[model samples]
Target: VYADNDPIVLVHAQTLLNSSAEGRTAYIRADVNEPDTILRSPGLIETLDLTKPVALSLNALMHFVTDAQDAHGIVRRLMGALPSGSALALSHCTPDFDPQTWQKVTDIYHRAGTPVRFRDKAAVADFFTGLDLIEPGIVVGHRWRPSAEDGGAAGEDGGAAGEDGGAAGEDGPAPSDADVSLWVGVGIKP
Candidate 1:
């Protein structure tokens, strides 16, 4: 199941994302601040099997959730509800790399009445505290699991050997790391 609180994005996603014959694609109007509401939602409960491993992806979302909303706690709660072997894939905006530029962006968000918090690497990494991270832990968005042709991240083994051409940016994707200014990683619950 996919969840998004933004009505506009939800509408767009509904039009674009569809279910396949073998599996179903479900969507829910959910807020990251309300873990309990999302966890208990009928759509999610009905579509997903909580007993088995479920992939929870939070791409480019958590940065909007400030510390007061318990960003990490919300993730822990969501992960806590699922059984072992569940996976978490997250990508968050960070000010660690181009701090001046990101801070200006944060100011813009604030001016628009939308509070934003661009976390540093340490804070972003905290989101995966209890899970075991995969290779190239918590690197910039595009650098994570790049196609073998791109040579992967700085020190990656470049072993996307059998990767089905679907790896992120398969056909020459992304700009510099500082340009992206986001942290991404995938972790599996033991």
Candidate 2:
């Protein structure tokens, strides 16, 4: 469920569908605020199986939601509807490190008509209150168990292993175990 109010994305989706004769794809023109409308849509309902475990991905979207809307509440509502064993994959921008740069980026979004509300590590963790975190726990995007070939430490830097060879402290401790612009984690409903 890719919810974006971008006309260009919709246009591209349409083109992809038209070009792919063997595969099946459909695009819904709506906003994330109206989740019920999306769930009731004929195509969405038919394509997704609510009874099975589904991966709810909210990458780079939560920051757009404000306090009044309760971004965490929105996530809980969607998770409640999914069956046990469902997984949630999320990545969100935070202000823990490089507050100045974060603010600049946020201001840019605001000027573009899509204002962003950044959260800290704790606030971001609240969104996954009821789910069980996967191994290595919640960490930055890159530190979440990278491939051995990547040649980087696992988990956020600066704790113990990071003392030897890791990114400098100017960026504040790599957030979790990776070097990413935001926090990322995967959780499973049990």
Estimate, for each residue in 1-190, the C-alpha lDDT of model 1 and write its tens digit.
8888889989898998788889877788988799988999998988888999999999898999999888999999999998899999999998886889998999999999998888999999999999999887888776666654665433344223223212345555346667778889999999
Backbone clash pairs for candidate 2 read: 143-177, 143-178, 155-177, 156-176, 156-177
Q: Lowest summed lDDT over 10 consecutive residues: which window, candidate 1?
A: 158-167
lDDT of 2 at 134: 84
Index of the highest-lDDT prediction: 1
TM-scores of the models, in the order given:
0.86, 0.80
The local distance difference test score of each candidate is 0.82, 0.72
Report the Cα RMSD per candidate.
Answer: 4.7, 4.6
Off by over 4 Å in 1: 151-174
C-alpha-based local distance difference test score of model 2: 0.72
Screening candidate 1 with a backbone cut-off below 3 angstroms (N, C-alpha, C), the clashing residue pairs are none
